[model samples]
Target: MDRQLAERLEIFERTGQVAPEICRFVRTELDVLDAAGSEITEESAGTLTSHLLLALQRSRDGGALTEFAADETVRAELAGHPDALEQAAALAERAESALDVVLPGQEVRFLALHLALLRQREAMR
Candidate 1:
């Protein structure tokens, strides 16, 4: 992990704004992305990391976004990137298993959109 991301994770962990499990999940997910040759860095994955942290925290607190409406444009974009969608769903499943919280379908779709964007950006480089 980059210094900036490590520092941010430390702050969240120390402040208790995010649970230890969530932090661990974020680290693990980032590691997975790195190992998969995604060239993940704090700048690249910051938003996705934040989103995952908040999603996990909300799920654990019973404040999960149950009424999320999937954006059609994003859905259409993801349809062309089945691999990203599948990878995002798998990552979400890991988060669910790690934190013992279920993510709604819309949340998974949003995650897929983010993942697809990240991969697309990386591909552009």
Candidate 2:
């Protein structure tokens, strides 16, 4: 894990904003991404990390988003990047297994959008 991300996770754990299991799950996900050849940096993964944390917290609290209206334009954009969508779905599945929580399809789509955007940014650089 990146030092900055580890520190951030520590802060969240210390502040009681994130459960230890959630932190561990995030760390494991980062490791998985790293092993898959994706650059796991604070800048590249900060938003994704935050989103995963919040999603896990919400799941634990039983406060899932009732409806997630993904923008059609964004969905269309993501549709062009099937690899990202597949990766996101795989990650979501792992999260479900690791955290023992079900992530709604909308949440999965949002995760895919983040990944697609990240891939686009990386390609530009």
Candidate 3:
């Protein structure tokens, strides 16, 4: 995930505008996921599922890194539906597992946000 963020940060850094907002959001999300990963078992699978769905939607809204043209291979892979979502969800699940073990009693508000975002994306689609 850090690798993915590094790649995205590099792209946004080149854009020279909206860098702060994008950087902050991406970094925060990464931090939350990292925290979740560190203590996942306490989290519910449904929560992780929700987060994956929302993340997919947010990815769509934030341009999803799917339109760069230069990274057709990555785009195609992500566009393959379940494959990308599954991989991302798996990561979230791992994070949830970690969160459960270390940060027990935590709420998955982000997951819910992700789900809502995904639903909006689907409606638009």
Model 1 is weakest, by summed lDDT over 10 consecutive residues, at: 65-74
Predicted structure with the largest lDDT when compared to the true one: 1
lDDT of 3 by residue, 5-91 (tens): 455544544665334444444445555544645222213233443333334334434533223333444434345354334534554
lDDT of each: 0.81, 0.79, 0.39
TM-score (C-alpha) between model 3 and the true structure? 0.28
Any runs in candidate 1 off by more than 4 Å, and if so which?
none
lDDT of 1 by residue, 7-68 (tens): 77778888999999889888888888889888777788878878877877888898877765
TM-score, per-candidate, Cα-based: 0.90, 0.87, 0.28
Instruction: Quote the positional error of residue 32 for candidate 1 in Å.
Output: 0.9
TM-score, cand. 1: 0.90
Clashes of each: 0, 0, 15
Best TM-score among the predictions, by candidate number: 1
Question: If the candidates were sorted by their TM-score against the true structure, best first, what order would they fall in?
Answer: 1, 2, 3
Query: What is the full ranking by lDDT, best candidate first?
Result: 1, 2, 3
